[model samples]
Target: MGLRAVSFFAIAVVSILMFHLPYREVKTAATESLNQRQMLLAKQASFGIESFFKEQRNLLRHFAHSPAFLELSKVGKDVIQEEINDHREFVKAVTIYDKKGIIKYSYPNPEKVIGKDISSQAHVKKILREHKANVSDVFNAIQGFQAVALSEPMFEDGEFVGVVAFLIDFKHIAKTYIESIQVGDDGYAWVISRDGTELYCPVPGHTGANISETSAQFPSALAMAEEMQKGHSGTTTYQYNKIRSKITETITKHAAYYPVNVFDNLWSIAVATPESEIYSEYQSFYKKMIFATVVLFAVLIFFGYTIIKDFNLQKLNKELEKRVAFEMDKRQQQEKVMLQQARFYSMGETLNTIAHQWRQPLNIIGLCVQDIEDTYRHNEITEKYIAETVDKTMKSLELLSRTIDNFSTFYTPNEQLTELNLYSFTKQIVSLLQEQFESLNINLKFDEDGTLQIRKSVFFDAKVYPDVLKQIILSCLQNSREAVQKRLRSGEISKGEIRLGILRADAEFSIVIIDNGGGIKEEVLDKVFDQYFTTKSVSIGMGLGLYISRNILEEYMNGTLSIKNYKDGAMVTIKFKDSKES
Candidate 1:
């Protein structure tokens, strides 16, 4: 009797616990899903706000560069008025400031602000001196209303003319974007300046307030502001008020914030949604789970009186499952490490390419130095000549710096797939290799059927690994160079010319590289892509070029690579699945 009673009680307790496990899991999943959604919503809202400001700035830039605006005096007053009026819904006014900070022109010509010297403003000085566009800090402007400003500098023939400054009404941005967000009951969205000043919040008390105070005057607001200041997007929780049944309840809510970049200015969007709303269904789940536990306990007590053993066997089975899972995880980690190692090994090729690219610029700098001495000896070293030489040297150094950056990008692994315009990609790779090939008197032309225009070709855009694509093209160019030299030595051809062709039709794009060197022998062509197979002298080339390229295209990019003979020359074609079709 004692054993039976103990078994029944144990069964009832276990069943009750089992009945509530699912409810706990469901609650956790719901919380995570809602938090993610909240963050996503915050990001989208931030993008929208940024896009709005970007468009506005672009519009001002266009206006500043237009011929009519450039010759402001030649254009009619109505033209300026019409322009400002068109954007008046969001634009408070437009003012033009010359290099001296003097207001050259103003739309609406407000009596007090029209001739006001704004050169004293920090942002105005920044635009004038730097010759760059900028967004100003929020301020109390005309009619004592809060507003922000954007300025785009104007230049004609590379000489500074003035700046086009546009004032934006803070209320417009809030009403159009911030106030429109629909969070749960008592939830809202707001915008804050980079300094944490509340620029646009639906709550009247919070608007125009600064939360950057170090003192814990308002701890919740301070925490929220600090999170937004961290940049990009993130989520944070703090104590907040949730009013219900005519009573104020202090509860915690999740807040997500995303930063917006306008010109050089940084602003942020914050969305607050009640944590209770995220798990409101949990209350019902809790009730149903309790009822289930009661029923399960009663059933187990009546029918599950006998204790079940074999816990040792069950534990052994669990141990086996854990061991299998651990092995799988370990293997996955090893595979990842191996892939990274392969990428690291490719750095040797990247370094060599960088060396080839830097040679020209370094030679230019050396030439400039030699010229300076030669000119001084000849008594022809004028200041103008020195300045010109220095300018050329600086330009060469800039090119070298950019080449270093390109090399860094060339081997970066795990890049996202992107749409590549066949013409642009071909042009960039050809340009990079053209200098090296030209040193050997080889002509490398990237064209399509002799009819494709630069930057305007519609034929070859596909999705693939850009770094791998660049590496493959570079390899082909190097091979083409060697092929030309081989034919020249054997008295097969006098002039060396390699043509890279871009071809596209119906769901695919192909890159074809053809060299006018003697075609490969039938026997050699079959094994040319094999690892460590080389025809060039030891000092000139390594044989991994075509082999690695084929592996990359086939295994990683879902593409095929093939080489064939074409009119007494070799032609290598790489075909890719077109992204547009996909």
Candidate 2:
């Protein structure tokens, strides 16, 4: 073979390896990255729960030392009903149990079990056993309602006389978690005791469902918890609520566990994200990656053909032009294919989100249906009930329209670059899904140093167009929101902080979004911003949010978009050159 032929072979090998080899390495890294993130998020959720209980313990301690409880200890029957009402949300019921375990005083005048319990309660046993501050796990009360308690020994001059404690209704504590933290589609957070018995679950009907109720089901998580009791911490992936026939069908495939110290129990606050959704990123990445590979291969072929010709240079050049034209046409076709896929995904998600948004109205419509049904059954058939039902249905119909309008706005194709306020833009995008976030109780906050405000102002006002800025902001917010939601499910966010910070450095304004949710895995980090690279499953698209954001900011807006490890969280920075320089 000639020297040129040898060179051609080497170059061909290099091109193929370059295109193919990185994918395997990237895929492995992506898997690792996802695992690490799940672990971190689980830790955060556990810590947050632990902190909440710690605060509850401290509050109970303060009440034990308070003058009112002290007076009750001395004179007894010093009813602090007024004081009790002052902190109704926190203090469920304050009771003084005599050293003999007989309840002496009950606040708010309990209807049942107030003067009943002579002892045998777990908190009473703990006070008898340890003779100190104690917290009890959720248990069915004599009144048949689930309740948890915190108790502390009352002392006059350090002499143990009785136990003063607070009784909390189950709904109050459970609802706090329910209303706080956004759990994506079909995602739910639950708390199970150290013994693997569910103490709190958002699904009211399913509370106290024994972890081993269906021994045939949930074997993995049940076994993992058994191992966890041996002092294991971090995330463990398992499957629950699955029937063999429904494997990968109706059953939720992935469950993440985080051990939280809520009260005395080593409560596992688990948030299960459907594997289908969490792994959607991977599928998205794969599709985009395949597309990128095909395009890259075509480009390499064109490059090789352009430089080296087996025929006359003139004839080969003519053929090269035709091949280049064909490649361009192919690229356009590929883009069209990707867009169609995007539209299909978007259309599906749009429908799902719309359904979620209209749940209230739909429920109201159901209520109306029930009312008419009830009226018909009762033989009333009054105009009052009929009018009420019609009014409600009409109101719901209007809400449905508004929901459709909101979705229409979201689904509208955006392709313009116009002037935009960075802070305002971020706020607007977040506001678009504020209801969803509020329902999940996920905290999303934007921060900017006072000194850095000028830099951001300059960047948005620079030679950069408005549409690019809007697209970049929209993409960043969406990613951050998804990451936050994912972490919340993994129990990875403490205080549920999703912070966006903008800073000025070296004549560039850096817009950074940081979340306490588990940090991105190093494997996922490398190709996270790559075009068409995604970690999503059950969704189809170009996975172009980060890629497009990067392209717009770096290529068109004359700025740089980069992602970096931010301690225990992920930080994405978009650096815009100073307007003065531009």
Candidate 3:
């Protein structure tokens, strides 16, 4: 009995240690993962801040370009109303200020401060001093709310005109960040102004609480805010509340800061998440480890007892053999299943890309069939006509062949480079899809003024896997064609046109596709490259066509693909290197 108790206690210690050991490893891994996630989120916040400013600049440009703003010397109440209506998202309130800093026209009506001179205000002064748009960090408004301001200097001819202030609601911005994030029960995120003032906090009913008073003490916030004042921004981790908070002990929480702009301010968009919350999975793993260790010890004791009770050890050997076999079979089965699933996913994506490639040629073939039928009906199907049609058919077939060749060669992953005529290569591809474009009443044209050649290149040099490029071009053509079709369907497009141009300038070669398909909406344009982003309910492509095409060009071919609004249409330009230049 003494030995048994000693053994049990030994087992218990081993079990506890086993559980505790993995707990340490898991905690370390968890901490690393949490740090990584916080870093990514910080990067995203930085991007969002930059994007916000870009949107502001764009809004200012919109007003600058407007005939109303350009023609009217003095902004009226009605003009402010129209501008506000046009840009509701960016414009919290459009208030036109006089040279004396008096509010001349405010859309939402600040009746109390209409004649007040805020000319000495920092934002207005900054705008006047810089002669350009000035962005402000979070601060108390002269009115009732907390906000940031984007003040653009209005100009009259070459002279500095009055200022136009677009008040950005800080409450809304903080609310968005709060609502979008999934914070742990005890974790929170907050924004602080450069003056050590807490601008926004995510906790319920705690909007104006000074961050310095919180259990976290806002040390990181103060550090980041100082950095923001110097126009520097990034993420950092720190330990705080070690003595005051129960959960913060031994846990290092991370904070990320995005400086508002180029201007000096103590304000930054800061995000904080508890390191322990992110690594909470380690605790569960530790418990399971302890249980497993205890079970292992129990099995050892049972084996010893059985060996003493019966000297027949053959049964034990057989049981061990059976258990080992069972484990081996289970592992083998799991590996096979994993491989099959992986193969299925890969093959499915490949087939989808292939389907997009096939649609164009099949449409072209259908058109040829119609052309042949029409000619026969008109008795114009002479041997010469038949020969011409046959020749066209053969050419189309050859195009499909070359597309296949390019695509098949890409699957090897590792292949030697060789000389390639980029001109002829793209020509074949365009020809294959030309008939489909014509059927959609899109005027497809190829303009190549110089010979462009690539040496020892992969599909990436061509901006996609040969087959993937086929799909991408087809998808683009299909989108343009469909856009035309929609207009035709609505009797809106009587004479639409699509143009495809390929040219070489200096060492750069470019493919420009322009179409008279009313351009994508401004709101959707920014998200156009996102995966599975689509305006239509059922899209022709998986929305990965452009995404994958871009990867091939920039990542593989060292090229660029960009889109812009053209005259009454959309223009997509793909620019790549003339490999010989390298």
TM-score, candidate number 2: 0.46
lDDT of candidate 3 over 357-403, digit per residue (tens): 66667677778899999987888888988888788777777766766
**Error in Å for residue 185 of model 2:** 1.6
Ranking by lDDT: 1, 2, 3
Q: Give the alpha-carbon lDDT of every model.
A: 0.72, 0.62, 0.61
Give lDDT tens digits, candidate 2, residues 268-314: 66655656565555576467656765665665566566556444566
Query: Over the full model, what C-alpha lDDT does candidate 1 score relative to the true structure?
Result: 0.72
The top-ranked prediction according to lDDT is 1
In model 1, what are the clashing residue pairs, if there are any? Answer: none
Clashes of each: 0, 26, 3
Query: For all the candidates, what are their Cα RMSDs to the real structure?
Result: 24.6, 24.9, 15.1
What is the alpha-carbon lDDT of model 3 when measured against the actual structure? 0.61
Instruction: Provide the TM-score for each candidate, comma-separated.
Output: 0.51, 0.46, 0.50
What C-alpha lDDT, on a 0 to 100 scale, does residue 107 get in candidate 2? 72
Candidate 1 on 80-176: residue-level lDDT in tens?
6876788787787878878888887777764656666888888888988899999888888855788888899988998999888888887777776
lDDT value, candidate 2, whole model:
0.62
